[model samples]
Target: MNAVGVIVEYNPFHNGHAFHLHVAKEQANADIVIAAMSGNFLQRGEPALVSKWKRTEMALKAGADIVFELPYIFATQQADSFASGAVSILEAAGCNSLCFGSESGNIDSFYQTIGFLKNNNELFQQKVKYHIAQGNSYPRATALAFHDLTPNEDMLDLSKPNNILGYQYILSVQKQQASINVFTVSRKNADYHDAYFSSETIASATSIRKALFSENGDIFSVRQYMPETSYNSLLEYKEEYGHFHDWEQYFPLLKFRLVQTTPAQLKNIYEVEEGLENRLISTALESYTFKQFMEKLKTKRYTWTRLQRACVHILTNTTKNEMDRKVEKASYLRLLGMTTKGRVYLNKHKSQLSLPLISKLSLQQNEQIMLDIRASRIYALGTRKNQQRLLEMEFKQPPLILN
Candidate 1:
């Protein structure tokens, strides 16, 4: 079977996601669609609004044939690493093509931008360093450097969040020399960070999430922005867990981690550096909530997302050494859910897969995947479910096999 891939978060699996999934398969003209969905956390350094299990169920019901968990290490990082891990998982799953939503839907533009960056890597790096030295954040610095090299709007815009990830997806494809051809579906109606509902049906995940939280998990407020399957999934998750996951939910635990660990010990957490330990600890102690703590911690040099990612590392006690030990590629394809088509594909290709296909959590013990287990445990604290039940959900539950 010809397979296509999508890298997704599906924080709540809104209509925009459903649209992307539908278009991706049509564009790729593949028999089955596979998704490398982020686990409990997301690339934006925020806890998922729901568990990965419900998100996987949403994906399968929406259009995805299979759902694979993008492990914690890659799922919560910035675009480049996130794209790398997603691409690796897709490749391992035997996808012949990849389709991603982007502001610039032109695939040629991505190749052009990547080729230009590669050719002028030295100059680009120098400019990035200069901008960073000038107090610009790393993401801002990279965008500035890209614009410095290409002053014209002739290439894909790296400043747009989806386009940036799309660019990184193409880069990861080239870097790994994978066999997957990539296509793009231009995002419609809303921007990546739009905080308000801009359309009747299409809304950004950010907007959906913001609305969900602002209304105190009232699924009806954002009902129009999601498919029925997704809408019901949101309802089901809320009914079971009593609350959606978010940074604020885990603030107490984060504060506990912050207050107990010394600055020296805090420095060991990934993304904690440049005396960020002192800032995090001091600010965490003074501020009562995650929002207040982040507000106090924000600086010109560090983005909100960057600080949250650092906090995620701290909350998980993920050390820099732990991440540094992870190799460039994903070691296993952690199946979360699948339809009948996906099962057939997997059964046929199981013997030829590049990475191990792990469905049952009981039989696997890779060190990198230990982070995923640890992350799920940490994620449970953000919800109202019994911690033991959630942990057991991680270990005892089998992959959701949809018919």
Candidate 2:
């Protein structure tokens, strides 16, 4: 009855993800796979191609036993914040180990990097700040700072996307002093950010998303790269919602928010800072599309991902104070979907679990969940269908139990 936890977005449950899930379960030698998945929005600050529920179904079909929603606040955050929140939830779910896909397949390298940085904490912090002051983005700043520390060849490469996230996952587990063992599996065929498909059976989620969007939702074009279950879910979602969710789909509303809200007010939103409001306002007024706006908005101080996340905060009207008040650790595990095996594991572990396991949104009353609620409303807003009907589903819908 042992369980292993994986931090995932499953933006579309493609072949690469299915591979990771299976390998993780096998490596951990666990009976159940618990996934801490991002909701409507992803870590890169983009809306998901499909809704969380649809993705949950894809996960269950792909082999995950239990799927938990990583709250919006954490889901749309940078790697460190994102990892910390997801790790906390998995630990709270009573996982015996954590498994992540990384460019550096060796788990020991992540431990080496974490321990090396922990011993050089002061210098590392100073270097990061110094880089930020020099107009580097947070990820860039961290990469520079990591280089400044001169980590050994045995250390994981913080420059790579998966490695950076994996490093943070292990670091988070250690910082929280959780008893979960950590493991890593090597990414195969395609890297995390690969934008072109080169492999026959494996492709990066980015490449799949790009292909799907560019092909105008021709699911068959990318069908070879994802499981049939994922392909079917995409078809179902397109039928019900009319189209897949993306930042381009949300741009008009986001532009409206940027134009209407005063710069002083934008400052209040989470992640908005340092006269960025003024810059964003100017960009919104001139640009008709998200792509045009992003082109004008890109700066060395902000990565494309960071800027998108800030834009997400703006669109959701999530304030700095609201995010600041909530503890970074998991106070609750919001169950999105599960298989019968998953339900059994939960029922057996319910009493021993440290956090409340929430299945229905209406039943859980916590301030931390408010951001998630707001995110869902915004996600529904992106759709062309009955907005109110979609919003209602957020509350009325129970966790998807895959039998």
Candidate 3:
């Protein structure tokens, strides 16, 4: 079967995402659509308002043929690593193409930019260093350098999340020499970070998340935009728990873990560079809330989300060495959900797969997997029921269809 791949967070599967999936299938003439999705934590360094399993189900019901977990280590990382991890997983799963939403929506321009950057690596590096020396943040510096090289004013607006991730996706595909065809669908209506929602067919996931956290927890407000399966899942989760919001309840445990760990140990955590460990250790002890601690550590060089992710990595004991070791391309596909056609394709290609396909959550001995397991346990500290459920989480059977 011909398949197209998507790398997504689907923090809460919304109408815009549904549109993208439909376009991906139509544009690629694909028989199957696979997604490499973030788990409980998202790239923005926040816990998902709803569970990953529910999101996977929503994706499957919304037209995705298969869904695979993107893993904790990669999910909470920067753009480059996140794209690399997601793309690597999709390639391993036998996908022949990839489709993503882009603000520019001009594949020719994207290719031109990628080609320019590839050919002028030394000049670009020098220009970036020059900008950084002027005290600009890394993103700003890199954007300035890129603009200087290509004189493309539009690409300089790397502040947008999708644009930044899209560039990284192109870069990864080029570097890996992957044969997967690339395609983009123009981003619709709401901006990625915009918290406002409209009655239009396209709505940002951010807006949906905000609505979910509102006092009434009104699913009806955004019900029209979400897939029926996703809306039902949200309602079900809310009915089970008072509200499907608030990750702050886990902050106390996070703080306790931060305080208990030594500075030397904190030094080992991913992104804990250049004495940031000492700052984190000191601030974590004095600040009463996670937000306050993060605020205290925030700088132009280190973004709020980056700092938050670093703290999470520290709390979860994801060391720099551990991240470096797992930096190699993904070696396995951990299936989360799939349709009948997806299962058939997998059955046909299973033995021909270059990487292992994982469906069972057996005890893994690798350091990275062990750390992820421990982090999953820690992530459950917010609620008693969740704690029990997490500990007993089983490897779901294949073809776990939503409907």
Candidate 4:
């Protein structure tokens, strides 16, 4: 049961995702393709366009042999932790290779950058500090320092979203000293930040999401970039759950949580650093809308995404102490969905799995899983769909086993 692992957040399973899956299989030449996907909430610090279960079904229907939940704590962090968590799950699941999409599309280039960073650890750190002193954001400072130190154009490209995550995936693999072979498929069509659809067969998830949630959005316009199965599933989900969500919808909850909690208490939330708790506390009172609050809180030192993640943590009452206390590695591989082949592979390799394989949520009882449940409950609340907002949906829903 040789398998290739992919870390994904098919927020809405678009054609580009389907293409990535196909390429991963071809590149790894593996019998199975397993995806460790984000559940409910996403890395961008927002609720997913659809539920994790629907995304899993889309993936399984398209090509994935198995889909595992990447756990909430790991799924919504910065790239380094996110990659580490995903890699840990795949490694534990006995995946022999890891495949990802990258802007550069060159695996050797990523390795080259990794080698330079690893070899010049001290110099890189010094340069990063120097850049920070010069008022660059941490991500910007790191990228600039890497380029200044290595003079590799590709290394500089690590600033891009996909490349940054891809670089982190390689770093995570090296950090684990795992034997997973790495591969990359070049991203196609629209860029990561592109906000509109321009092609019939390819579109960025960002673009697709923007179209889905925009007030004037025509869902049919974005449907051309999704497979029939995915698009149809999305349509059904929309019919049942209303429309996809934006963080703004949860503004009241986020604002209420922030306003009620003191700065000292806000400081306890994960990712609340550099006196950000004070800023959040102050800004939360003055700003009436989520957009205004984000604007007031955002700083050059603290990225918008980082602030959003912090707000989500605050909203969910995810304390830094709790995350710090939880084991860094993924404790379990929670199954979201699977194909027939995936079931067979799981049965054959059950004993070989490094972590507990959880097909049912009830099988695992831990703080981390509880956090995931909390996230799902919050996501359910934001759905704005009367019948579909049940928290029990997370418990009652079983893995979508596709034939």
List TM-scores for all candidates, in order. 0.98, 0.97, 0.92, 0.96
Please identify model 2 stretches exceeding 4 Å from their true place: 215-217
- Which 10-residue window of candidate 1 scores lowest in summed lDDT? 321-330
lDDT of 2 by residue, 194-290 (tens): 9989999899999988988894656788899999988889988888888888899899999999989999999999989888999999999999899
Ranking by TM-score: 1, 2, 4, 3
- Runs in model 3 lying further than 4 Å from the true structure: 153-157, 215-217, 384-386, 394-399
Q: Which residue pairs collide in model 1, if any?
A: none
Off by over 4 Å in 4: 153-156, 325-327, 386-389
Write model 1 residue lDDT over 174-193, tens digit each, in one string: 99999999999989888899
Candidate 1 Cα lDDT to native = 0.89
Candidate 4, residues 178-223, lDDT tens digits: the string is 8899989899877888787778689998888887767788888787
Worst 10 residues of 4 by lDDT: 150-159
Task: Evaluate model 3: give its lDDT.
Answer: 0.78
Q: Please, what is the whole-model Cα lDDT of each candidate in the order they appear?
A: 0.89, 0.89, 0.78, 0.86
Residue pairs in collision within model 2 = none
